[model samples]
Target: MITAYKKNDMTSFKIKVVGVGGAGGNIVQKIYLSGLGCETIILNTDSQAISRHRAHHLITIGKTVTRGGGAGADPDLGKKAAEESIHEILLKIQNADLLILVAGLGNGTGSGASPVIAKYAREKNILTVGVFTLPFEAEGKKDVAFKAIAEMEKYLNTMGIIDNNVISELVSMESSVKDAFDLVDRVVKNCVESIISIVQETSDVNVDFNDLKSLISRGGLGYFAKGIAEKPEDVDKAIESVVFNPLLTGVTISDVKGALINIKSNGELTMNHFREILDKIRAHLPEKAPIKYGLQKEGDHRVDSYAEIYLIGTTGKRTTDEVIDKITSKQTNWKNFEIPPGVRKHKK
Candidate 1:
């Protein structure tokens, strides 16, 4: 195992991020290099693939099964590879207070190994959360993706999902495939950054690690979004961005069971800034739902002035079914009309 540390103790609440497979490895590398100060591990079946990443720890699984090759897009082989390397995987995550698993579900290692690792983490009494991306309809991996998601939910405390189909529809027609993927990566990175800021930064009205645990732990199907205001005058507009983010499509805020609102600014934060953001958030959530907020000061006022709103909301069983349906169901009326893989197009 390779290790890199910014702090000897990392943080009071240790967060470990483990990325499984190619897509996951790329995401973890971005997080590590971004200087989030979290312990990161990147695991792959292929030696060549694992060599490409620089992280806190790098691991190669299934030496016997794959012989340093790869899983060949087969999730079964991916699962077996992880099972073959369970001991090593368990060692990397044993000490973490919070374990965040990142993967793109559909094929091979990410779809296969992530759920297994999460199951192990949950058994160790770690608070596990998952951030995953769904394959587009054209990829023909919906069945595999949904199956992995079900397995993950069985073990994770909460999860944030990004549907590639939704993202594809939202991006400009002229944008390349790489550009679309970069946006997905940014969304996952923002989620991790939000968590880090809330627990690591000190505030007058603080939301500690325990507060976050109470709100998100075992609260299924969560939504996370980040919004920014260039100056104090635009704070309301930022709140609107947080609430109406396209990533949160099909989720109902009124049914939300728990909420966390973190505001980070380059300039001085005031009582009115907090009240305005909180009141707007409160209007959408149920009165009985518990809420926590954290304020953090960052950046330099001389160069730029901005307030970032990081909103995390979790829902109960009622919205969970609705949200899952929205992701797994087929939509035939899309304007672009990309066919699912292996389907023949009908003649006019």
Candidate 2:
């Protein structure tokens, strides 16, 4: 079982899981088995699509819009189904503490419902995170996947959303379908674990839904980062020295004046070590920029020597102006880009 200390005395946290089709069904099943100890709810736009799969904790939502078909064949039906799914999900998760979205890329249900669900959840004060899979690059679904990703990113900028891409290089290395699914499951579980820890453990370093939302919305090209020792010998020591538990999500390099650092620990954190790391980062900071730092403790976890830094970059109007100038310089002639003849039209 997953063990975690509770910071609040609430009876139980409500977590809703919304899946799109077969891919989403698979992810929800794995999360159900992960045993995070929260009340679970599941929503699938296509009920018939996931009828073969069963979960005691899931609550399937909406009727099937299409049978024995792919998402690309019918855009209108896809949008309608997604709208119905979101409506069902909102009604079920009114008092939820968290909403976890799981689905595969290039689909109408997953892509369409995710943003709407997230918007409603945030308005209800629910912490939201999305674990979505991307389509394989050569599958001719790149445009579909890209549009979905861009939409999700825009929503996340304004709301709390943490995403894991299933089509990464590491995921591609898996030999079998089961192996790929397992790898993706592990990554999603780890991310969930970290979020749970932050919520349950009262630490000075706790990250709230708002903080996460702000970081992701502004941070461009976000990637995870973990701390590693400058040097290593044995594997165990290496693991201990390098803090694998630290998950730095999303990073942006724009208009960032400085950062406010907060540290939390059960034990004493060496001020010198903390300063050393900060100093190294500050060297790169713009001159005369303001930086704030603090330390506190309230969590159950002990911190002999641990620190996780989330680097965020900010951008301003100046950056946009510069980009426009750079792009215009290379444009000798301008023409409206259009789709080639006979390309598949978006289905109504």
Give the alpha-carbon lDDT of every model: 0.74, 0.44
* Cα-based TM-score, every candidate: 0.85, 0.56
Candidate 2 residue pairs in clash (backbone atoms < 3 Å): 157-217, 202-299, 222-250, 252-313, 254-314, 254-315, 255-314
**What are the clashing pairs of model 1?**
none
What CA root-mean-square deviation does each model show from the true structure?
7.7, 11.5
lDDT string, candidate 1, 1-348, tens digits: 111112223248888999999988999999999888789999999899899899999999988998879887788888999999999998999989888888888988989888889898989999888888888789898788878877777788888777777764456655666776777788788777766666665554456777678767845777676667778887877777666545433354565677777777775657688678778877877887777776554443432546778777777543445556855553212232222232313334
Please name the candidate that would achieve the greatest lDDT relative to the true structure.
1
Off by over 4 Å in 1: 1-11, 248-252, 297-305, 317-323, 329-348
lDDT of 2: 0.44
| C-alpha RMSD between model 1 and the true structure | 7.7
lDDT of 2 at 237: 30
